[model samples]
Target: GKKVIIIGAGIAGLAASIRLSIKGFQVDVFEANSYPGGKLTEIIMDGYRFDAGPSLFTLPEQIDELFALAGLKTEDFFRYKRLEVNCNYFWEDGARLSAYSDLDKFTKEVAYQFGEQPENIKKALDKSAYIYKYLAPLFMHRSLHKWSTWLNKKAMASYFRIGKFGLFHTMNQANQRQFKHPKLAQLFNRYATYNGSNPYQTPATLNIIPHLEFNKGAYFPTEGMHSITSSLYTLAKQLGVNFHFNKAVDKILVKDKVAIGIQAGGKSYDGNYILNNMDMVTAYKTLLNEEKQPTRLLKQPKSSSALIFYWGVKKVFPELDLHNILFSKDYAKEFKAIFKDKDIDDDPTVYINITSVQKANDAPEGAMNWFTMINVPNDQGQDWEYLKAKARKAIIRKINATLHTDIEPLIEVEQILDPIGIATKTSSANGALYGNSSNNRYAAFLRHPNYSSKIKNLYFCGGSVHPGGGIPLCLLSAKIVADMIPKP
Candidate 1:
């Protein structure tokens, strides 16, 4: 069998390994960390287990497709149930909304809470579906950098329809124009942060995000988010893929415009093809140091990072669901604090995801694991110690005000993950969560391609490359790369 060396055993890398191994390739995956899953790993605090990264689970069909390709039952490896209640939204003024998976119920709930016209809510959801329908096949499922993608009649048709389906407006502008109440607009505008983009600057095309959660339905794994990694790792191993942990790759061994293999742990392992699934910026700065860098793509504005507080709360509120959003009063100011001022807003929008609600074993009896997070600027030499301390207070204040409970005392155990910590741990440049921000409508076309332009037999896959971030997109990136490499 032909050999393929996969770098960084992230979600994309794991997916790529599975696909290539099925295609009759000897897949050898090398990971820097002792365990796989990249940012999709988990943490434990005082008997409470929290998914360290990528809490929200959507588009599980992407994972199912891999197992299907292997002719294996996905349920045997991994399983997830669609959430009936997608998320619970809370405002400071005592306005609460339960976004349901059922469109009729959600429309009625929104109408009851915000007095928004049910027809308007449905229309807004239809618009999101419209955008996702035309864009997914062309921009998301395929490689944007390839000429064949633009030349194909079907993809070209979809590409041209973007002007019609995806309105030329910022997420904030589109929501403001679509809804009468600012609260409803703010609720929809929060979708931009799904990819770590500023709603005020990111193109309104991002509004399609709601379609996934509401229309397709949000889901939670039977175990926890970490099970996503564990299951995939197990599947990859079953397919005869090799994994070497704690062997951080030193460099990509390239020769005469061809990727030969990689140097890791002071030794070199040659392969027929090399696939880099690490962040593009760090890969260029370190792995491909000798090669000419794609400066423009690397210089593009990075997506916002996150400040996560893994708090093991001693008390559980039956009112709070698996997903909860405590919105900021000044939504625009909160975004400005992240993208412009490069600081956390005093009243930042806080997202609290509790897996314990779904899997009781995640925490102690009557307790919950709070994966509390707030979007923040990526690393820029700022004082993270000060910011983390300040943000912690702001978060506590926001939670107390919205939940009507002094949560500071409920904390039995606490652990923090800042941008600096994320950067150091994951080797992600600036700790940008989703690689490049889709701030502009053209951001999709600006992302690095799935394969290296200068180096032959060199491929790229991951959130940092094409098709963007999140679990689904990362899985798609791997499919794109695996498709690009010809089977022996």
Candidate 2:
């Protein structure tokens, strides 16, 4: 069997390791951190647990498939429930909307609160579902860069239906055309941010994002989001995938434009196949320093980063669920600050994820663990200290005004994760949550491919590569990378 080496033990790395090992390849994974999961990891402070990154959970089938591949039941190793109430949205004007997982309930709620026609909401959802059905088969399931993908009947059919995707217009324009109410349009437009994209600039095809949560349904693991990592890691270990934590890969040793091994700890460990789970830009500049790099892909606009405040509150709010969104009054202005001005918005949209709402021991009795976050531009040598300070104040003000509570006083324990910290921790270029913004219509195709074009026997996976970021996409990247590899 050919030996394969995976750099970084992120979700994609772990999944790739498992997939390759199952395919009869000897797999070894090297992670710079002491633990696995990358951005999907966890943090615990003062008995309050928080998922360090990616709070939302969708696409349970992707996680389950890994266990099934190992001849095990998903429930035995990992378990999750579909969230009945996916998220509760709040506006500055005291208007509230609960996005019920049930389509009928969600339509009724939207109609009652925003005075929009129920059928209009339903029609929009139906369109979103339609777009996803076409796009997922074309864009997600396979690599766009490969000629084999384009020759398919399904992809050709999807290409013909491209006009229905509204690729010419921005997401905001599409939403505005669908809904008469500003709030409803804003709600739909926010879906662009799911991929770290600007709604005003990104193609309306991204409207497919809402369908994932609303039609397919949002979910939560029984233990916590981090369990997704821990369980997969456990399975990988059981499948004989070797992991070397706290081992930073210094160089990807190449010969004849082919990946042969990695240099780490001043030693060389050779392999037949090498898969990089690190951010593609960092991988090129650092590991593949001597190799011909893909400059155009490396130079794509980095996606928005985040400023997170993990607070252990002494009190609980029953009105809040697993996910709550406190939207900015001026959505367009907020994006401008992120993409154009390269800073946080004065009125940034705040997302609060309370895992303790489902996991009882995540916080002390009568206390809640609030993972509060706001989107900001990625790291660019900015004064993060000043920005974080200003953001804290602004976030506190927003939360207080929307929730009708002095949230600052309820903080019994606290920790913060800023862009600088995220970049340092995850090795994500510029601390971008997603590798690149999908602001441009071609972003989906512009992402770095799963396999390197210039380097043979070298592959890439994770949020930084093909198919974009988020748990599901990262997992899909692993599958695509695995599919690209020859059988052992």
Candidate 3:
């Protein structure tokens, strides 16, 4: 059997290991951290457990597909429940919107709260669904760099219909055209942030994100988001895949433009195939160590990073759901601050995710685990300590004002994760969460492909590669890499 050396035990790396193992390849995963899951890992502090990264769970079938490929029942290994309330939105002007899982309920709620017509809401959602269905086969499910992908009849059909996908207009323009109310437009505009793009600059193609959460329904694993990592890691172990923790790859051993193995921990391991789950730019500079770099790919503008405050609250609110968003009053100014100025806005949008609402064991008897996050520019020599202090004050002011509750006294434990910490921990270039920003219309085609054109038997996966970031896309990246590999 051919041997595969997978770098980073992230979702993509683990998923690739499972697929390759099933394909009769002997797979071994090397992770730098002591634990698995990369950005999908967890944090435990002061009797509170939090999903340290990727709080939202959507398109769970991507995770389940791995189990199915291994000839196992998905339910036996992983379990999750569809959330009744997708998210609760809060506005400073005393407006509260409950995004319901049911389509009719959501449409009616939008109509009642935002004064938007139900017909318009349905039309917008239908448009989102149509865009996703129309482009999934061409842009998402297959590799754009491969000639095989372009030759397909489905790809040809999708290419011809690309004009209807709204490549010209910005996401904000699309949302504005669909709804008269600014609130409704703001609600849809938030979808651009899913891939760390500014709605004002990103293409309307991102409008398809709403369909995944609203129409397909958001979900939560019964054991919290960490279970996504634990379950997959467990499956890889059961498949005879060896995992080496705390082992960082120092170099991609190459000869004559062909990847041979990995050099890690002052030792070498030979493999027929090498898959790098590390960020693409970091892999080139740190591991590849060549004088010449992929200049164009490296120069791409980075996606926005995050400032997360994991708080162990001493109290819980009945009104708050598992996912909550306190939107900023001036959304455009907020994006401008992050993208153009490279600083966080004083009135930044705040997102709080409390897993204890669903899994009781995540916190103490009555307390809650709050994963409070706000988007910020990727690291660029900014003073994070000063920025964090300012952000905390701003966040408290917003939450207290919107919720009408003095939340300062409710905090018993706190841990902060800034872009600096994220970059140091995950090796993401410039601490960008989703790799590169999708702000440009061509950004979809600009992402680094899953397979390296310059090197033979070298493949890439994870957020930094093709299909883009988040758990679903990372899984898709692994599938793309596995498919591109020839049968052993």
Candidate 4:
């Protein structure tokens, strides 16, 4: 069997390692961190456990597909339940809404709370489904850079219908036109943030994001989000894939324009092929410095990052679901702060995810673990210390007003992860949560491809590459990379 070397052990890297090994390649994964999982890892302090990153779990079939390929039952190794209540909403004005997982129920709640027609919400989601149905098959499932993909009759059909996607309109424009009330438009507009994009500037084609939650559904792993990584990591090891931790890859060794191996841990380990799972920007700046850089893709704007406060609270709030959003009063103004001004607004939208709501062990008895976060511009050499201080104050103020509690006093244990920490830990350039902001209509097409054009036997996967970020898209990136590789 031919040997392959993979850099990074992020979700996409783990999935790709398993897929490659199953295809008869001797896979060796090198991760800089002492542990695997990258951002999709965990944290424990003062009897509370928190998923460090990427809380939302949609497209369970992506994880299921990996297990199915390995000849195992998915539930036997990993388990998750569909969230009945997707998320609870709160506004400073004392308005509230419960987003039930059931489409009919959610639509009814939207209508009842926001005074929009129930049918209108359904129609909007249907349009989202239409885009996802057509767009995913054509662009997401395969490599857009490949001519064969463009030549496919199915892709041709999708290309002809681009106008129907509202590609010319901004997401805000689409949402506002669809809803009579400002709140409903604001609620749907928040979907743009799923990929760290700004609805005011991002293309309406990104509206397909909602269908994933409202139609296909969102879920939670029974063992917490870290289980997604642990279960897959265990499966990869069991399948005979070798992983080297704390071995940072400093350079990608290439020979005559062909990727040959990696230089890591001050040693060179050769391979027949190279699978680079590192963030694209960081990889070019560090690992593949000598290789011809894809400057165009590199120039694409980095997506918004986050400022998270992992707090172990002394009490629980029954009104809160597994997910809760304390929306800012002015949604458009909030986005302007993040994207244009490169700062967080005084009233930034705050997201609170409590895994303890489902699994009791995540927090101490009669307590909750709050994964509180707010979106901010990715690290541009900003004064994060000042930003963090301002953000903490704003988050405390919002939570106090919306949830009706003095949360600062309830915090028994606390830790903070700003964009600088995110970049330092994950090697995601500029600490961008997603590789690039899908602000432009062509962002989906502009992402780096699965395989390198100039470097043979060199491939790229993970959130930084084609198909974009999040758990599902990262898995899809692995699939696309695997499909392109010939069996060993």
TM, every model: 0.99, 0.99, 0.99, 0.99
Question: Against the correct fold, how does model 2 do in TM-score?
Answer: 0.99
lDDT of 1 at 272: 98
Residues 417-455, model 4: lDDT tens digits: 999999999899899999988999888878999999999
TM-score of predicted model 4?
0.99
Error of 2 at 54 (Å): 0.8
Give the lDDT of residue 206 in candidate 1.
91
Q: Tens-digit lDDT track for model 1 on 1-488?
A: 78999999999999999999999999999999999999999998679999999989999998899999999999998999999999999999999999998889988998898899998888888999988888888888889888888787777677677675655878888888899999999999999999989999988889889999888889999999899999989999999999999999999999999999999989999999999998989999999999999999989999999999999999989989999999999999998899999998999899999999999999999899999999999998889999999999999999999989999989999999999888887888899999999998889988999998899999999999999988889999999999989987
Model 4 stretches astray by more than 4 angstroms: none
Cα lDDT computed for each candidate against the true fold:
0.92, 0.92, 0.92, 0.93
Kindly report which residue stretches of model 1 are placed more than 4 angstroms away from their true locations once superposed: none
Write down the lDDT that model 3 would get.
0.92
RMSD of 4: 0.8
**Model 2, stretches more than 4 Å misplaced?**
none
The lDDT, on a scale of 0 to 1, for candidate 2 is 0.92
> Candidate 3 at residue 89, lDDT?
95
- Model 3: per-residue lDDT, tens digit, 1-488? 89999999989999999999999899989999999999999999989999999989999999888999998988898999999999999999999999999989988898888788899989998999989998877888889898888998987887888888889999999999999999889989999999999999998999989989988889999999999999999999999999999999999999898999999999999999999999999999999987357789899999999999999998878888999999999999999999999998999899999999999989998899999999999999999899999999999999999999999899999999999999988999999999999999999888999988888999999999889988888999999999889889
